[model samples]
Structures are given as C-alpha cells and as structure tokens.
Target: MKVSTLRMALLIMISIGGVNGCGGSGSSNTNDKSVSPTTPLAPETSQGITWEPGVFEGASNFAGRCATPRSGVDPFTGASYPDVEGSAFEEKMWMRSWTNNTYLWYDEVDDNNPADFTVASYFAQLKTNGVTPSGSAKDNFHFSQSTDEYNTLAQTGVTASYGFSWEFISSVPPRQLLVRYTEPNSPAALAGVPRGASLLRVNNVDFVNNNTQEGVDALNQALFPSQSGETAVFEFALIDGSTLNVTLTSQDIVVSPVQNVTVIDGAAGKTGYFQFNTFIRTAQSELIASFNTFIDENITELVIDLRYNGGGLLALASQLSYMVAGPNQTNNMAFETLQFNDKHPEVDPITGVEIQPTPFYQYEIDYAAGLLTNTLLPSVSLTKLYVITTGTTCSASEAVINALRGINLEVVQIGTPTCGKPYGFYPTDNCGTTYFSIQFQGVNEKGFGDYADGFIPSSSPSFEYEVPGCIVPDDFSHALGDVNEGMLFAALAHASTGACPATTLAGNAFERAAGQHKDGLSIKRPDALKSSIFLQNKILVPINAPK
Candidate 1:
C-alpha cells in the first residue's frame, strides 16, 4: 500500500484509542521511512499483551510478499507440473516493522493470537515452545540481540562475514579450457599460474560437459568446507599439450582491498594513487596500513586503483576515508541511517523501569570503536585521493569513491567505469536462511549516486582484458608489470626524466615482459613511447579500456 494511505490508517487507529492517543505529530505512518517498530497497538504503559502477526512488504525486487508454494512442470520435456522432480519453491514469510527491522518468520500464522506471532515476541515464544535456533539457523541469522540466543547458535560456528563463497560447475564442452583469467593477486594468481593455459580437472574429479555450477561449488567446498581454510588441488592442461597439477591452500589471507599509494612526482605534484579491490570487512585495517606505509615510503603521488574490486562491507569503506582523508570527514552518510526494531527493553533513563520500546537510533557518527574511540582514533591529512577505477568496483567499494570525493579530496580517476551499487544491507534471518536487503541509502554531499549505470573513469586505461576468461598458467600476454609496482609510473615519467621499458604493456603479460630497472632507482617508460603508456610515479595508469 502507498505510504500516505498507511499513514491515514494508522492515524485513524490512534484516534480510536481516545484522548491521549493523538499525542504524536499528525505525521501519517506511511510518511515514516525509518525501518523500526513504532506503530503503537497498545497505550504507552500497556504491557504483556499478545499481538497479531502481519506480513509487510520488504524492499523492492523482493516483491514484498511471503513465501508461498509455487509448483511448476518440466519445461524441457513432457512432465506433470508440481509432480516433477527438482521443482520446489520456498515456503517462508518475511515481515518488517519499525520494531522489527529484519525479515523474520514464524513457524505458522497464529490466527487465534496474531499479536503473539510478531518478532517482538519471538524470544518469549521460543522459550515457551522449548525450541532454539542454532547450527544452520544460527549461521543464517548472524545478528541476534539475545546474548544467550547468540551463544547457542554460535557453537557450530558460522561463516564469518568476510568469508568467501564459490560455485562449482562442470566443464565446457566445445570450447575446451583454453585459458583462465586469474585476476592479478587472486588465488590463482598466488599459485604462480600465468595466463593462456587449459584446465584438466578439479580435485582429481574429471570435468563433466555441463557441470559449471558443480565445479565452482566443489571448489568452494574443498577450499573452505568449514570455518578453517584448506588446500585444494587443480590439474591444468596447457595449450602446449602439457599437463601439471598444482596445490593451493585456502588460507585466510586478507587482500589489500586498496592499492597504489603514491604522490605525484612531477612539477604539478598534484596527483596520487589509491586502488581499492573490495569493500571486504577488513578494508579499514588494510587501508590504514597502506596509507601509513605510503607515508613511510615518502610517496606523494596518489593513484587509487578500484578497477577489479566488487565491494563487500560498507562500514569499512567509510572508515577508509577517515584514514586517507582525515577525521571530521563527513561527506556521504556512511551507511544509511537504520532504526532499531524497537526501543530495546532497558531500564528507563528517568524512572529506571522497563517501558514500551521507542525509537532509539541517533543520526551521528558511530565509528568502529564506538563513541569513545570515535573521537580518539587518529586521523590523516591528505591533499588529494585519486581513485583508479573500472566497472567491477561495486557496493561498499563505491562508498569509498564517493566518501573521498565528498571530503574534497582531489580525485583523478583513470580506467573504465564502476559497478553502481549504492545501498547497503544488514543481514537478517528467517526460516533457516539468511536474507539481505537494502536498509539504508547514502548520498554524497553533492547528492551524486543514482548511477545504477556505473561511474565513468576520468582517464581511461589503455587496454582491457577479461578477468575470468584469461588463461593464467601459460598466458603472459596480459600480466600487469613493474609500471604497476604499486605506484603510478606513467605519471612519474612525466614528473621525471625516466620512462617505462619498451616491453611493458597494460595487460597481464606485462608482468612477464617488464624490463628490470637500471639500478632500481626510478620509474620506467618505453624508449619509443609506442604504447601511449607512461609511468606516473612508476605506477601504471590506464587511458581507457571498455568493460
């Protein structure tokens, strides 16, 4: 229903409560955008009353509806509908109210007692039913308010927020595995696998013609079957007709989400580089370490690379800005403001007695270290924060780009564009599965981020190569080289007399073909300048490469 209509209905409901009921601003309930349980069914002092359960629409795209049975027949061949195998639809319900910020479910609707079916009563209900949510259910609901409830579910151990998910699929039929693009610094990257090679098998299992998902799933399971990382074997068939088996352990190694920290080395000395890979949860720590490392190394030119990052945690993205741009830096709101599901059951501030829950979120900076540390953490001073970007950088990754720009950081971007993902989510659970949806929206100070189409890089890189399709074991044609030795070489060459070596290219092959430095003192550029490629502070900045 439209918010205006819902507000009218809520106002009418309040009027029925008598004289003291109309105390709130005559604002219609529909006008409230906060996702919390603020609707008052009982009077201010009322308590312990059973309430009826109702389903409310969640964010768009999920089609605000409960899980209902959907039966279908086999489409490929003749098969009876509903009776066909592998035809099952989810049967769950999701509800959202001001007092219930998450999507939750009840075993079954309690028509006889709807009020008792609400999420607010879930704790009490679970106790009465002698049931507990743990193991699979606990992992599904990563965030829970009840300490006891959380402890019980955590026993089996859940996949931490930053964990990886992989899908296994069968082999490619006609194409045969010609090559694989193990992104620079990816798992396949660490295995010393070059581009231009072939795949033989996964963990000794022969590749089936049509089991792509199975292959991916198998990889994930083998690599991270539980909370701990494990080693998995990959057998590759090179295009040269040679085969080799490589073993790689799935270690909990944290990727630098951010890279290329340097200051412009030329007369202008006005540019810098900083590349962000993902919004992964540890981005905050990694970014801090990077900036400090840059400062220690005396790098002034800045060229941020976010070309291949797909984004992860939004909170870390916000914190990254503070490390690079300094404190008191408020540009785009970190995450969208979130309202609590209810006024948590706490002793009243004035009377010291439990009361009905009310609105609790205060719009302000809630740093990673809470209020005390929010003011205590040290901040960095930066004149500019240039971002090197591409279409793959998304979600929380985009948050950093916008946040840096908001704080007036001089950001000169080079590459293609960005993956537009502006909203962030707080995962919740219901019916033994986790579901995440947009809970808040953030806009830069200039109000720029409706770009579902993605952000265009100010300067385009010179070449573009597919990430997943590049063959890593044998192909060196697309490798990133010394120009990418963590600094902007092209910018550096213009800043100094040095130039890139002739062999350096923009693809992965550059790594294998890069020429050694004269004495490891300056950035390198080709003598002929044939590639239109130059080194900025010894870092490789792209001119343009289409997604």
Candidate 2:
C-alpha cells in the first residue's frame, strides 16, 4: 500500500496528564491555542464575515494565506513559499471547515461563527465537549503547537533540559517529587543524582509546602528553564535520610529512547528485559540491535518496560511487534486497521486512499528515506510476553499490547492502568500552527478498540478490558531493571508461579496516597511540566512516501 507523504510524514503527540499538576495547563507564546470556557464568542459582524456551512475543500483555498505570511523556504516540507497575505478571519474559516470535515465527532461540535474568535481560540472550540466512559474529557488530546517545534522534536528528539526526568508522587501543595531517571552524561546524572531522590527545594523555594501561585510559578520557572546555560540550585532528600544540594546547568539534550537491555536468569528461564521509552525514529536502530542480541542469546521470555513511554511512531510499534511475534504468526495478518469518521468509511479522509490495515512490518525501514529495506528483523517468536506499565504508558505503547493480544498471544501486564488512547490523527498545519485533532480510531485484528477507560491489571479479570497480572506500585528505591523492583519482581514471580505475590504494606500505602490525591503522579522530564500534553504518545505514520 502506498502511504501519502502528506498523511504519513510527521510525528504525533499525546497528552500524558500530571506533568506540572494533573490539571495544570501549559501555554506557548507562539502556539497557545486553547479556548477558555468563560471567554465569550465574538459578534457575527466582528470581522464583517458571516458563518457559512462549507466543506474542507472550500477551506483549503484559504490555507496557505496567513495573516502574517512567512518568507523563505519551509523547513519541514522543503517546499518553496506559497503563503500570501490574508486576514485572521480567513484562518479561522479554514480551521472551522477542516475540523468539521475531519474531527471524529464533528456532529457533536457547535458551529460557532468564525468571526467572533482568534484563529487559536477558534480552533480550540472545534472539538466535542463529551466525556469518556471513565468521566474524563473525551477529546483531551486536541491541541496544537508551532509547526517548526513539532517537526524538530519529532525528528530529532532534542529538547532543552537540565536532564532530570521527574516522577510526581503528588502534584498539589506539599507535593512529593522524585527522580525517576536521568540521561547519561546529563547535568543531573553528572551531578550524581540517583533515582528515587525526593525533591526538597529549588533555589531556596520550598517545593513541598509552597501553596501560593506566585511561589508555584517561581518553582516552575526554576525547575523548567526555557533556555540553555541557565543554572539552578536544587536540594534533595536521599534514600538514606541524608540531604544534598547540587547546582546544575541546562542544555539542549537529546533523549535516549532505549535503555537497560539486560538478560536475566530466572527460575522460569532466561528473560530478555529492556526499558523502551519513546517510539521515535532514533529508537529504530537501538531496538533492532537489542533484538539481535536477544535472538543470539536464545532468551525464552521477554519483558518490556513501558512505565514512562508516552508513545511516538505507529510504524515503529508495528516493527517492534513484528520482532516479538515473527513471520509465522503475523504473515498476511493486519497489525492494526484504522477506522475514520463515518463520512469516510471506505477511504481515509486525510490520505484519500482506500482504507486498509497496517501490516506487521517484517523488514527494516529507512525512516529518513521512507522506504522498506530487504534485511529481515530479528524475532524471538514468543507466545507469551510481559509488559510493565503506568498511567503514563499511552498511545502507540498501548497499541503494542492491544495488537499482540489481538493475535491471541498471552500478554501479562504488571503495574497500574494505562492511559487509554486508541485514536490518532495526521498533524494538520495551517498558517504556522500545526493542529492535532482526533481523526481516526485504530482497532486490532479482532476488531476491538474501545478502550477509553484504559487497560487494567487485575487478579480475576472478568472482561477483555482486564488482563491477568499484579497491580504493583512503582518501586523507586530499586532501579527499574533490577530483579527486586516492585513491578519487575512481580512479573518474574508471576511467570514462575502463575500467581501474584501477597500485597505488601508499601503497595497499600502507595495506593492510599494515590487515592487521596485525585490525579496520581506522572513520570516526565523537567521541561515537560508545562507542555507535557505535546509529548510523544501517538501512532505516527512513516515520515516519507513509499517508493
């Protein structure tokens, strides 16, 4: 199947709530395009343009015409300038028409006049205000960012940071934060910051007890600095009850998506374990190399750690799933099939191609070139798989579990419920802002995709939504890949004994704390606190057109 370059070429971002706080919002000077509920709609004659029912093609005529037209070559598409001077009303018109044509629940959206709102605010109100089965906002993933920043993060995985990935134990007053992990050679790792160290203060501002908005802003500014060379002093409470202070400088850090690939000898057998982070282009080579090692070592079982993995490319997920199940089981089978809104049942509304299933890709893909290579991918062909998850595990990460289970493979999940998201979209750019609105729902081979409430691990699973596993709390004291870590230990133990271990006091305490705090902690990079909604957590199409 030939994938359209316009539809396939880009990264998809997913919102993993609880970066700053579960409800704290992020903003950008260039691309802050959300509407406040209290903001009144503009008058019909505000811009001397009245609302009209129109199709997306009618809006396409106004697409390249920006209110403030940009000059020079476009960095992302490598195309010449097509922009022309236009009014903001024209931009808002484009947003309305495009959203009407593509948004999954377009019928549920209110047809407000475009003249009454700014382009950003107008685009924000284009989604449905419905709630999911779990009572969470149904269209929470609708958001936008600058086209340049979106492409840069998707392709390069580089972001400004001081290098500490934080896990929020609590996001309210008296917040409890801990170091989840650090990038190697980063300022935090170089300063000897270890996992599980509790954050105490930032530049003398009390992080735990600060309640005022001003104090919170100061803390956010210090912890999530926007530029390189910025410095901050941090105090941490170590595991041994000792306190330590460290001064660190921020820099442009490239994220390492794959880490801690180890082979563990257990009573069950040799288990191949790896901590897989994001599903970006950079992760392709690392995953291949790790799978090659596992194949050579003849490991019996596989444990994939996705506790902090938000998500990224869908093609990469397909590749990884292929490596896990191999050719015999996946041959001529669909990995996933996308169903767009009812209007475009037989064809993709975005790509204009006939609806088809995405296959279990068995060969290496040249992501930069957007072509498949002849080299075969390594696979363990295991019938049973182990996955470690958290609420942060979302989008393409959830797809991996769903796709494997669709094929009747045994998947034992360990940890809390996953962030439920089976929807995806091709990032659409108009003017300079790239909008991400849900356009399609992805289902596995069995035609099951309604998982909006998330996948839960339970002792006695009564439905397909529940899987047989232990609900273990995250173990911060022990390293992630350690044999004794809370989640991993339970997974290994369950593999050997086919039963869950007795619930411990620590696990109960963690659950109690989470219950008391409405929104449990999220694992995220320090810089992600503000714009954690734009993090990698969707299934991206390939970046190039098929040859």
In the range 1-547, model 1's lDDT, one tens digit per residue, is 0111000000000000011110123232223332123344343211222233554333221222223222443332234222211100111122223113321222221222323233333222221111111111111111122222222222111222112211111123321332323434445666666544555565775543324556545633553333334666777665456776777655433334444444444554544456554443344455666666666656555555554454443344444555566544443233222221123223222123332211111112222222212222233456565454443445555656665565456554443344444443343333223233233334555555554434543223332111101111122234322344322443344334333323332453312211121222111111111111000000000111111
Best of the candidates, lDDT: 2
Please estimate how well model 2 matches the true structure, expressed as its whole-model Cα lDDT: 0.75
Query: Which regions of candidate 1 are displaced past 4 Å?
Result: 1-91, 95-200, 204-232, 237-244, 248-276, 327-380, 458-481, 484-547
- The 0-to-1 C-alpha lDDT of every candidate, in the order given, reads 0.34, 0.75
CA lDDT for candidate 1: 0.34
**What RMSD, rounded to one decimal, does every model reach?**
20.2, 4.3
Give the Å shift of residue 315 in candidate 2: 0.3
Error of 1 at 2 (Å): 35
